[model samples]
Target: MIDNLIQGVFNGVSTGAVLLLAALGLAIVFGLMGVINMAHGELMMFGAYTTFVVQNIFKSLGEPWSDFYIFAALIAAFIFTAAIGFLLEKGVIRFLYGRPLETLLATWGVSLIMQQFVRSVNWVILAGLLVFSILYFGGVWALQRRPNWDAIKNWAIAVLLPLTLAIAGSMGVFMAQIYKIAVTKPWFGAQNVDVTAPKWLRGGLAIGTLQFPYVRLFIIVLTIACVIGIYLFLEKSPWGLRIRAVMQNRQMSACLGIPTKTVDALTFSIGSGLAGIAGCAVSFLGSVGPNTGQNYIVDTFMVVVVGGVGKLIGSIAAALAIGTTSYLVGSGTFTNIFAGIKPLVDFFTFFATTSMAKVLLFVLIVAFLQYKPAGMFPQKGRSVEL
Candidate 1:
């Protein structure tokens, strides 16, 4: 019984670590910018796909290179998803700011589009589109910022627009040919893909009677590092300070030369990047599919809300509480605890089954929210007014 209890707690912490990873980005994004990013899950999908691509690339290189692919995949996933998030903010989210309903609808549409694109479009074409978007948007942004270029802007547009398109098109064709030569068949199609764990991460570590899987341990360690990194960035770094200032008072921050717009873009990108990392971590647990992100979106939002929006410590505490409760209930730990009491045993027995655990957990969350609607740690200042 003691061993079971210890095992349950360990399993619960592992589960909580995954939840924490998935919720971290959502908490930051929603807390900082009152925008409910419906497509946040899709960004995670992108990260998983990025990992898939990296895995294939490394595999093609040789056996030795394949073992270290995860490291490269993590970095690639972050940059890839961060770029997408930045483009998303600049292209669509920027215009929908302060309008929650529209933002939600737009992001939902984007999510659907992304999923379908992955299912229908070839990887080569997706790469081309990504390249095109980056170059085109980058050039336009640069042109827009130029001083007193209005007179020549039209001519510059006429020359630069086609040039950018031509260059991007050429690159796409070049990449496609190279891809065809290197990989005879497409790496990904409509079906899901699996990311195999490295040899080092396989199996479990034994501590007395309890066993801990390396993958779960890695996730826990990674989550701790991310939390610490974010804490340091927000507390000790200038950009993080700017982010907090903007979060506290956007208009005032802008007035004080804080560049609120840049802060928004940066914050969103970081959040998206974190989501990507979450996806990479998730890939180790199961197959990577287009719909993978959807699985965690609801739970992630719950974590953020229960923890109190914008409160990091609150998020951590909430994740652990929710995760542990769910695991304990599902594992019948609660039912066992009530075994000696007839009435309590019957009550827990009914609710402690795997299928019913989620229902019970949800009910508990609802009850908790009824008592503390602002969450365990509500934010003060202009955030409340907004």
Candidate 2:
């Protein structure tokens, strides 16, 4: 009984840690702007795949120190995810802000596109060129933010035009390499990838009567560390202050010369990067499927909603509650305790079945929300509304 109890609690904490990682990013973006980023899960998927790529690279090299590849994977996931988020904000999200339904729909569409992209590399060359064009001309547009058309045109011709052409030439060379791969590489077709955790993390830590998996412990520790780092970044750093200022009042922040637009883009990128980190952590938990993000997306959102939007402490508490209760209930701990009551035991068993657990969990959350719609820790100001 004691061992089971210990294991169950550990299970809950571990599960809650994953939920916290996944929700933290959503909390940052949703809490600040009231934008429901339906695509946040896909960003997590990007991180998982990034880790997958790193693992494969290390395997191909036949490196004995492959365990260290996770470091590279973590860095790559953060950078790639952050860059993608920045581009998405600039190209799509910025236009749809303040419109919750529209933003959600648009982000959902973006998520679908991203999923399809991983299954195909045939369009890489075209995508590369398009990216180059955007980067080159986008700078000119940024310079033209003040709307000096003649000056903008002159700058485009004198500077951006030549730079664009040079980049185009470089892209041509890059495309040739990609063309060769497209013609010859049979593995470029749509297929799912898998990631295997390093050998060092393959075991467990045993304590007198209880045992805990190292990977799960790594996840729990990593999550706590990340939460602390984010707290410092948001509360202690200048950029953090700028982000909070913009979130508190965008118009006022801009008036005070806080560069609200840039802050929005950076904050979005940071949030997206956090999701990427979650994805990398998830790679060790199970198979890195294309739809892995789909598994946790709803639950993480529930964490955000139940915890209270934009409230960090709320997210933590909700994650712990949801994570612990869901595990205890699904693990049949209560069912065993009530063994004498056949009907009650059967009822618990029914929901503990894999498919129904989520359904039952969601039903409970919906019921909870019916009474406290603003969540457990409701924000005090503009953050509570659209």
TM-score of each: 0.86, 0.86
TM value for model 1: 0.86
TM-score: which candidate is best? 2
Against the hidden true structure, what lDDT does model 2 obtain?
A: 0.83
Q: Which pairs of residues clash in candidate 1, taking residues 3 or more apart in a chain or in different chains?
A: none
The pairs that clash in candidate 2 are none
Q: Write the per-residue lDDT of candidate 2 for residues 1-386, one digit (tens) a residue.
A: 66777788898889989889889888989977778888888999899988998888888877685877888998999899999999989988899888999999999999888876666544544555586678776876677677677766775668776777677667756766767655334332355566777888778999987889988998899899989999999999999999888877888888999987798899889989989989999888787766778888888999999999878899999998888888878888757766789999999888875567777888999999999998999878763454
lDDT of 1 at 330: 85
User: How much RMSD separates candidate 1 from the native structure?
Assistant: 3.9
Residues 198-255, candidate 1: write the lDDT tens digits: 8888999999988888998888898899899889999999999998888787788888
